[model samples]
Target chain A: MSDLSVLYDAPGPKAKRNATIGSVVVGLALLAVLYVVYARLDEKGQWSWDLWGPLLDPSNEVFELVWQNLGTGLRNTLTGALVAITLSLLLGVVFGVARVMLGRWARIPVVGLIEILRGLPVIVMMFMAYQLLPALGVNYEPLPGPDAFWYMVVGLTLYNLAVFAEILRSGVNSLPKGQREAGLVIGLTPLQTMVMIQLPQAFRTMLPAIISQMVVVLKDTSLIMFLGQYPELLYQAKIIYQDLGNTLQTLVVVGIIFIAINFALSQLAVWVEKRMSRRSAGKSIDPIMATTAAPVKV
Target chain B: MNVIIDNFDLFFQGFLKTLGIGLICMVGSLILGTIIAAFRVSPVAPLRAVGTLYVNLIRNCPLTVVLFLIAFGLPTIGINQSYYFFGCSALIIYTASFVCEALRSGINAIPAGQAEAARAIGLGFTQNLRHVILPQAFRTAIPPTGSVIIAMFKNSAVLGVFGVSGDLLGNAIILTGSRGFDPVPVYLGIGFFFLMITIPAGLVLGYLERKAVILR
Candidate 1:
C-alpha cells in the first residue's frame, strides 16, 4: 500500500473489478501468442531429443569436440577483449586528460580524433585494419593470433578510446571546482592537483562506467567473427552446427554460454557499485562540519 | 568511387533494405517497449514480473547471439523465413529491452503525486497513463530514446553477419570481394549513409527534447 503511490492508488471495489477483467484479458491475449509460437516451434521438431541429446550427454564424443572448441574460442575472445581493454583504458585516460588540460591547439586535434572515431561503425574500422592495412604495407606478422585478432583489437581500441575518453572527461569535469581550488590554495601546481587530487576521485566515480564498457568490449569481440575466420565462440558455434547438423541446439548452447558470462559480469559490476556507494557514503560523514572553519553554537 | 558508380543499383538496394529494416525495427521496438514499460509500472504482480524478466534477459544477451538464434534456430522450428525477416526480428527483440528500460526511467521520473492525483480524479489506469503520465514522462525520455534508436541502427549493420546481403555492410563486403575494390572507400561510403541517417536524427531529437512540454 505504501508503494502504491509510486504508480497509482489502490483500486476501489468498482475499479478492482475492472482491473481484474482487464488483466485477465491481457493475460489471455499473451498466452494465445505464446501458444502459437510454441506450436510452430514444436512442429519443426525443435523439441526432439535426437537433436539435443548429444549436447546434453556428458559421456558423448560430440561433447568432447564442443568442449575443446569452446576452450579455444573462449581463450581467443578473452585475449582480444583483454588486449583491447588494456590499450584503450590507458590511451583513453591520456586523451581524456589532454582534452581537458592541454592548450587550445592540442585540444582541437584530440576533439577531432574523438569525433571521427566515435562516428564510424566498429565493423568498418575492423575491416580497415584487417583488409586495408596489409595493402598499405602495415603488416603485423609478428603479432600473435590471426591478422583478424590484431584488427579487431585495434578497431575496438579506436572506438572504445573515444568512448572511455568521454566517460573519464565527464567524470573529472563533474567534480567540484573547490577540489581544484583547494589544491591551488595549498600551493600545489595545476598538474599536481590534477594528478594527486582530481584523478583519484575521478577514477572512483568512473569505475562503474568503465566496468560496463568492459561488457561492451566482450560483446564486440563477437563481431570479429564477421570480418574473418577467428576462433571466437560464435565462429566455433557456427562450425559445430554445420558439422553436427543441429543448428538450433548448438546455437542454444552458445547463447547460454554468452548470457551466463555477460550476466555474471554485469551483476558483479552492480554489486561493486552498491558496495562502493555504501563505502563512499560512510566516508563522507558530517559534510558541513568538515567544510566549516569554526564551529557554530547549536 | 568507381566501384560505387558501377554498383549503384546494388548500393541503392542495400540502402533501401537498411532503411526498411531500421524503420520497421524502430517502430516495432517502440510499440513493444511502451507496452513493456506499462507492464513494469502496472499495479499487478504478474505483469511486473514479466516485464522485469524480459528486460533482464534481453539486455544481458548479445545481439549477435539473438540474431544467430533467430537466423539458424527458426529453421529448425519450421518457421523458416528470409534472413532479412529474421534479422529484423532479432533487432526488434534486442532493441526493445533498451527502449523499455529507457521508458521505464521516464515513468519513474514522474512524481508519485501525479499518479495519485490522477487516481483521485477517478481516472483509470490506461486513461491516467495516456492523458497525464506519459506526455510528461516523454519529455525526459527523449534523449535516451534517441540514443537507443541510434545504437539499434548501428547494430543493424550486423544483419550481414547472418548472410543477409541486402544491408550496407553486406553490400560493401560483396562489392570489395567481387570488384577487387579497396575496402577503405567502400566502408567510407557505407559509413556515410549511416551517419547521414543518425546524426540528423540526433540533432532533431535534441531540438525536440528542448522544446518538449513539461507538465510537472
Candidate 2:
C-alpha cells in the first residue's frame, strides 16, 4: 500500500506561522461576536446573554424553518450553477472559435457583441430576461413559476456566452501559426482544421480562464432574486435574517454557506489546473527528451 | 416624444438616481478594492487569508445577496436607513469585490521588483505603494476597471428591483405594471439610459488607458 504522507503533509514553516496567527484571529473574532450579541440584546431591550442560549438549541422551530429554507436554496443554487456553467462553456467555445476564425468582414460585429454584453452587469441582464422577455411576447412555460428561472438561466447563458467567446478568441489567437499551416497541409477543411486541431489545443490553454469565468457566472446567479420570484440561497437568507433582526448572526450561516460553496468550486478549478499542468509538463520536456542527449554535447 | 415629455421629470430624476448610485459606488468600490488588494498581497499570512476569504466569498457570492442582505436584512436589525443609504451601501459592498480583484490583477501585472525597488530607495511601504507601484498597476488595471465601471453602471439599474424610491429600472417596472403601457418602450428607454452612462464611461476609460500609455 502506498503511503499518502507526502500528499497530506503541510508546508512546515507556513503551517507554524498560520497556527499562531489563526489562534489570534479566532480570538479576536470571538470578541467581535460577543460584542454583536450584546448590541443585539440591547436593541431588543432584553440586554442579556440568555438570548444566545436559543441559538445553541438546535431543535427550535425558527431555526428549523431557516434550515429548511437554506436546504432548498442550496438545491436550486447548485442546479442553476450546473445548468448555466454547462451552457456557458458550450456557448463560450462556439463564440470564441467563431470570433477567431471570422473573416475581417465579420469580425467586428462579433467582437462588438462580446464587449457590449460583457460590459453589462449580470443582474441587469437577469432583469431584462425576467422582466423584459414576457413583455416582448417571448414566452416559455416552465413548471408554474412566472418564467423567471428559465429567463435567469437564459440570460446567464447570453452574458457568459459573450465573455467566454472573448476568452476563447484570446486563446485561439495565442496559438502559433505553425499549427494552422500543419493542419492545412494535411488536407483538412477549414472547419475540420479548427474542430480537430485548433479548438482542442486552444481550449486546453483556455481551461483555467474558463473555470474562473464560470465562477463569476455561478456567483452572478444570486441576482435572480429581483425577478420577483424564486429564492436562491441569498434570497432565502434575506427572508430569514431580516425577520430575526440579527444580521451578524444570520449572515454567519449565510456567508459561511457562500464561502464554503465557492471555496469548493475554486478548489475544483485548482485541481483541474494542477492536472492540466502535469499533462502539459510532459509535453514541455519532450524536446529535450527526444534530443538524444544533444549528441554528447560536442 | 410624447412619453418623454409626459415623464420628463420622472425620467430626469431616475437618471439622477442612477448617476448618483453608480458614481458613488464606483468611487467607493475602487477605494475599498485598493485596501483589500493591499491586504491580499501582504506578506502576513492571516492578513492574506482574510483578504483571500473576502475576495473569494464576494466573488463567488452574487451581488444581490450582498444587496438584499443590506436592503432587507439590515433594516430589520434596526438600521432602517433611507433608500439612498441602503442602495449605495449594497452597491459599494458588491462593487468592492470586483474592484479588489481588478486592482489585484493590476498589481499582479506589475513586476514583483517595483515594490522592492521602491523600498530599496528608502521609501516606506505606504509611500512606495502610493508613489511607485500604484502608477504602474493603474495602467495594467485600466481595461478591467473600465469594464468594472460599466458593470457598476448597469447594475445600478437593479436598485429598482430592490424597490428603491427612485431609480431607472424600478421606475420602468412601476410604469409598466401600473400604467399598463407597452413594456418595450420603457425597457428600450432604460437600455438607452444605461448605454448613455456605460458607453461614455467606456470611451473615457479607453481614452485614459491610451493616455496612460502615452504618459508612461
Candidate 3:
C-alpha cells in the first residue's frame, strides 16, 4: 500500500524531502537576488523608490494616472471586446452554417474569408484596419474620439470570426447522423432538425473552444497599441514608463494587470467549457478546471 | 490593371522586399528559437530558468515596445544598430517565444521511455538527446513548429516600419497615404500576397500533421 503511494507521485517521500531542501535553497537564492535588486535601486534611489513604491502610495501621481487611465481603458477594452464578441459570433453563425449546409459556390467565398483572416497576424489586422478603412470611404468621421476605435473592433471581429468558424464547423460536423435521422422520422424538416436538435448539441460541444478563443480575442486588444492612437491600458503604461524612464517597473505592473485579466477570462472559459463538456459527455458534473495544455487534435 | 501595370516594377520590388524580410526574420527566429528551446529543455536547471524568463518577458510584453525601445530609444543611450538588425532582433526574440513553446510541446510529447532507453545505453545526456531523442522530437515538433513558422511569417509584417523599406504594406502606406490613393486596394493586395505564403504553409503543415499521427 505504501509502495503504491510512492509509485503514483513524481517526487515520492524521499524525493520530496530532497526537493523541499532544494526548494528552500533556491528560495533563499531568489531572496538574495531581490535584495541585490533592492540595493541597486537604493543606488539609483531617485527613480527606483518612487517608481517601485508607487503601488502602495495611494496619492502618488503615477498611481492616479494609472487609475484614471485604467478606468477609461477598461471601459474601452470591454467595448471593443463586446463588439468583437458580438460580431464574430454573428459571422461565425453565418459562415459556420455555410460550411455545413452550403455548396462550393457559397462555401468557397466563406472559406477564403476564413483563410485570409485567420492567416492574418492580429497586430497587422489592426494596422491594416487603421490604414485601410479611412481610404475605403468608410469614413463616418462624424462620430467621436478617433474612428480607429471602430476600426479596431472590426479588425478583431474579422480575425475571430474566421477562427470561430472552425470551432462551429467542427462542432456541427461532430453531431451524430442519428439525431438528424430521428428528426426526419418525426416528420420535421431538415432545417428544423438542424435548428432544434443539431445546432443546440453542436453549440454544447463547441462552447469551450469558443470561450477559449475569446481569450485570444481579449489579449489581442493589446495590439491596438500599435496604432499609437488609442490610449489603452497598455498605452497608458507605456506612457508612464516613457515619461518617468522606468520601463521595467511600469511593465511589471502592466504585465500583472494583463495576466489578471487573462486569468479571469480563462476562469470563465473553463467554467463554461466544463459545464458544456460534462453535459455533452453525459457525465456527473465534475466541474473540473481543465487547465491541461493538452495536445490539440491535428 | 493599369495602376499595377504602370508600377509593376515597383510592386515586384515591394513583393521581393516583403519576401526577403520574411525569409530573413524566419531563419533568424528559427535559429534563435531552436537554441533557446534546447536551452529550455536542457537538464541544467539554471539554464532552463534563464531561457524561460527570457521567453516569458519577451512573449508577454508587447513586441512593438521592444522594437521602439531598440530602434528609437537605444540611440539616445549611444547604442547603434541599423534598423534592419533592430527589427530582426525584436522579431527573433518575440516570435522565438512562440516557436520555443511550440517546439517544447512537441518535445514533451515524446514518450519518457525514449529517454529512459537512451540512458539505458549509458549515453550521456547530450549524446543521448542528440542520438536518440531529438530526431524523434523533431518529427513530433514539425507540425506545430510548421504552423508557428507560418504564423511567424505573418508576424514579420510587424517589423515593416523598423526598416523593411520597399515592403508590401508599409510601402503601400508610404506610397498611397502620401499620394492620396485609396489605401484599401493596397492593403487588400498585400493581404492577398500574404495568403499566397500562409495558405501553402498551412496545407503543408496539415499534411505533415496527418503523416506524424501519434494518435491519429
Per-residue error (Å), model 2, residue B191: 1.3
Candidate 1, backbone clash total: 0
Candidate 3's TM-score on the B chain: 0.89
What value does the lDDT take at residue A91 in candidate 3? Answer: 88
Give per-model TM-scores: 0.87, 0.79, 0.77
- Ranking of candidates on DockQ, top first: 1, 3, 2
Minimum summed lDDT over a 10-residue window in model 1 chain A is located at A289-298
Off by over 4 Å in 2: A1-57, A61-66, A135-137, A140-146, A238-251, A274-298, B1-9, B42-50, B72-80, B213-216
What's the C-alpha lDDT at position B35 in model 1?
Answer: 87
Candidate 3, residues B4-43: lDDT per residue as tens digits?
A: 5565676677777767877887788788888888777654
Clashing pairs in 2: none
Candidate 2 residue lDDT tens string, A91-173? 87777777778898898887777766665567667766765677668776652375667777887887888766766565566
In model 3, the Cα lDDT at residue A151 comes to: 64
TM-score of chain A of each: 0.84, 0.73, 0.80
What is candidate 3's TM-score for chain A?
A: 0.80
DockQ of predictions, in order shown:
0.36, 0.20, 0.21
Model 3, residue B4: C-alpha shift (Å): 3.0
Q: Under CAPRI classification, how is model 2 graded?
A: incorrect
List where candidate 3 sits over 4 angstroms from the true fold: A1-47, A50-56, A127-137, A142-144, A174-189, A192-208, A238-248, A263-298, B39-43, B47-59, B65-79, B111-128, B131-133, B161-164, B210-216
- Alpha-carbon error at A62 in model 3, in Å? 4.7
Which runs in model 1 stand beyond 4 Å of their true positions?
A: A1-5, A11-35, A140-145, A278-298, B1-17, B213-216
Task: Give per-residue lDDT, candidate 2, residue B107.
Answer: 68
